[model samples]
Target: MTGEDILYPPRASAFSWRIFKTGEIHTVSVGRRKFSADFQLVFRLIKGLIFLTFISILVTMIALPHMTIQDIVVCILAFMPTGWGMLQIAQALKPLVRRAGFWGSVKTLARGYEIVMGLLLFTPVAFLAWFPFVSEFQTRMLFNQAFSRGLQISRILGGQRKGRSSRNKE
Candidate 1:
């Protein structure tokens, strides 16, 4: 192992979807008959698809709105990402609730809530919540620029820079 690698091990996975999916198996046995079902796989697949849909809607809301699309489309797509994010957050909290028990789970979820709130407050996504439609070309362009800059600022404030050790003690 390299010096850096020794100094910095990968962060413990806070939450894992794979564990939710294919982590547990359910079976029933009655009088020498066994019935088994793989529910995790299905659940995981749905979550993954929801994640994908969220991403696509985010991109569409940010990009496609400028390409002469209808205002309704932009407004509808804008909310999808937030809804999907909430779903994933709920999913993430399940393991915490199970492993940490009630109070610990609440603490963990509160931390996650803070992170999400910070993201929403710092980005143009916050404005979209109130006024989602792009009414004018100039307004759309202005928002496009705002979103780009807001994203950059958000990264600087909350995101880890690339190629650096994630284990850096803050």
Candidate 2:
């Protein structure tokens, strides 16, 4: 056996498997090695769960005024679309960020813009409600940020793309 083989026992060769007229062979992956497809399945599963969570939060955001936890829970949960969702989207875009060489910088900047907007739209209300001592200037700044951030975060969470408006719009 080669040194590499001694260090890591060779896994069963997939091609070595006998393909009879039968449907398939149930071979469990024995060694510590996990196939690349397994990793893909796991990533997809995580993405699905996050999507479900975002949908639930969006529903909550829409169906306001009748929930039990209004003051804190509602406020915090409301930002799920913007704060949590866009951050997740930015993370998801890592591969895309790595790809397009010429457009990478521009797209990455756009992604950052989206995340910032998401924070602006959703974070302030929660902050204001939770933290009592925020000054007027801070509030206005937060308000201004939210207008753009809401769109950014929304787009991050699988919503359509939204660009930031001019300062005059704020």
Best by lDDT: 1
- Lowest summed-lDDT stretch of 10 residues in model 1? 23-32
lDDT of 2: 0.45
- Give the TM-score of each candidate: 0.23, 0.21
lDDT of 1 by residue, 38-147 (tens): 46565556556656765675466446433234543544354345435644665677776456434333344446557866886777655654664634644767678767
Score candidate 1 by lDDT.
Answer: 0.46
Write candidate 2's Cα lDDT for 1-170 as tens digits.
Answer: 66644543322111111121011111111111243466766655655665675567546534542334343344444433444444456567766645733233334445655786789777977777665566665767778876756656655654332234344366
The alpha-carbon lDDT assigned to residue 75 of candidate 1 equals 41
By summed lDDT, the worst window of 10 consecutive residues in model 2 runs over: 20-29
Clashes of each: 0, 7
Model 1 TM-score (2 dp): 0.23
